[model samples]
Target: MVQEEKIPSHVAIIMDGNGRWAKKRGLPRIFGHRAGVKAVEKIVSHAANIGIKYLSLFAFSTENWLRPKDEVSGLMMLLSEFVDKKFFEIIEKDIKFVVSGRLIDLPDEPRSKVLKLIETSKNNTGMVLNLALNYGGRKEIVDAVNKILASDIKDIDEKVFSGFLYSPEVPDIDLLIRTSGEMRISNFMLWRLAYAELYFTKTLWPDFDEAEFDKAIFDYQNRDRRFGMTDEQIRRGNI
Candidate 1:
């Protein structure tokens, strides 16, 4: 039997279409958000099982604050519930939970819960599951720059600035998947995805499952990631 191809070191996702999925079903948008959480649980477990070292999910964006208050509150509530319900299972699985993006804007309770969860899972040896909450790509880059400027180093290189970002140890994204037919990155991991392969699907987040994920991986495996080198050079160099 053929062995499965080596799993990607890191994978990022733009979990879009929750609101649209809800509207299509004539249900409250929060319902879609709630269902999306189930998808998160399934995908994370499968990712870990399949040997994906790092998984990043765009859970909340900085611009998400503009959404309806009820929806935002519901999202936070779901986050709390997820933490309360999954912390032990996550620890048992040895999956490390990490949060990216701004923390100051998050309400005290949710912020505290996130901190507790991260602390509890910090030493886990399994996949690193990163939740991008209150996250924006441009804002993250700006924050990294500001942090670099504040440091003692006079000259800043890309490597130096990158080390200041939220989680410097995480590898650059290898594949970024966006569900709901979205074709854009939507300010999710702008710097980190500089060389990442992107996959867009019309399947809504609620409907996205292991099969869809496998398709994305299959597509990624077929890509010619030459980066900047010529095809002939890559062919000879065994990239």
Candidate 2:
């Protein structure tokens, strides 16, 4: 029998190139960031409708703090505004909003907004929308290691270690998509993306709409995952 196309249980995206998008139009970078917000809303709603269980977005990274102070400030304000505006709508849609990273590292206003968003959506039983803010892949690994070291348990394996990460409830990523033509992982989620099918597009994040999102999922469905098994094994349905 011909194998049916598989739907990924979890999808992660590195939203890149907002600043570049704004620069090309001779507009402030914050304008691109603002436009990216609408794209985010469209993609999230579309993903939930299409039966994707988990959607993790790399919103802000540890390295992003190295940007100019004004830009960082603008980003923080935008994040706060996003939460305030979208919290109730997401709850009504039965989507659970989650933020994973060093929460304390964020400014007071954004941090408070994030906490409130999580609290209000905590009861929802639906697709997860995970925002990785002030997050780094290597840093997450180190943090997990520290958690394991402090514990009394002796068992150390992939499953056990995964529980120590910031967001352990979510499963490993099945597909990872990066926009703006970026070719690197950029420390988004090191451990979770081990065997994920990767997709890259030249389209900037601000302009990445539902059609672009559909294309990413379509590309992912075409990938044949072996998980270290031989091609013959896969063909024989042994994987």
Candidate 3:
């Protein structure tokens, strides 16, 4: 059982295997993406109920643009529709909606909807729902560096550099869950995942549920995070 007090403050997820899920069913990839949206709905609600303070979902990656044009357009449409459908629920639930990526690269419809979501929910005092659309960890670091260069900041440290990130106020990830049996981070949250506990599941993203999420939390709870200290040091409360 996961302890309530030990619940991770920030949980990030790499939602993968949608294409594979659709391929396995001999259906179009868009169908899989559609199914993945439903899973996102379920997991978001469950995360709030389970005391997850911050839930970041990697919805679209910068590399995803290399895919077929039709599929890309379809994804944009889906995102716009999803935001429109969930706009009221987000406000009513007091969820703070945030986006971690370049909104300028998004299609006009989706970009406008996303900005609206952030603006409308700015005052919500509840669990934060961060969507990583068109996000690449490497790109994020580069973008931050460019900002620093433009400001003519010669001296900088990790702490100061972090403030330039797309979502600077969000804390470092505590738990990172990747589905579809993928073991790689794939350029997601490069800076924020410095010391995060990673959990990979064989279950596809469309099939990931509350129970699957709990299993990851349980696994995380059993681990002893020494963070470079010896076990004896941890036992002696010398962390």
Candidate 4:
């Protein structure tokens, strides 16, 4: 059995291919997205069960607004439903809820729901569930830069600037997983993923479950995280 000590402290996921999954099944795209929420619930429980401290999910991106209006509206409705149905479960599990992204742009009902959930879960002690809604990696970085420039700090390094992000309390991403065979980061957590290990899988978001998640964890266990040290130096413990 693999040692549980090797499990990553934080895992970020780019949940993709919902529409494609729906198309493959000859169902409406919204059906796939709805199903994806179920997958989200399952994965959250599994991550907490396996001792992951933080799980950040890229649910919607800033660029997603360019899609058809109907689709966007549908997504918002689904998000509202998700919060209404899952907030209790999240609280029961002691999972703290947080949201990243341009939340001011969301509609009033969904925005209010998100805020309520965050407030309700703020005191929880279990895993953190960070939902990236209307988020963009580049946008987050740019916002951080703007904030730094606007502040009174004389000099701002990477560490200093990171503190100005949406959730500065969180640590850097330890592992990033992108589903549906996507090899790119898709503008997700560009700054935070500086040293994160990347994992890609062909499984689509709606179909990703505990088994697939375990596979990613298993793969992560075998990696050599030298962090730029030469192989021989790493082996000899000589930095």
Largest lDDT belongs to which candidate?
3
Model 4 RMSD in angstroms: 1.4
Q: Per-residue CA lDDT of candidate 2, range 97-209, in tens? A: 88778888999999998999888988898999999999999999999999889999798989999999998988899999999998999988999988888999999999999
- Residue-level error in angstroms, candidate 4, position 82: 0.9
Q: What is the Å distance of residue 236 in model 1 from its true position?
A: 2.3
Local accuracy of candidate 3 as per-residue lDDT tens digits, 133-238: 9999999999999999999788999899999998898889999999999999999999999999999999999999888999999999889888889999999999
Alpha carbon lDDT of each predicted model: 0.90, 0.91, 0.94, 0.92
RMSD of candidate 2 to true structure, Å: 2.2
- Ten contiguous residues minimizing lDDT sum, candidate 3: 1-10
Off by over 4 Å in 4: 236-239
Per-prediction TM-score to the true structure, in the order listed: 0.96, 0.96, 0.97, 0.96
The TM-score between candidate 2 and the true structure equals 0.96
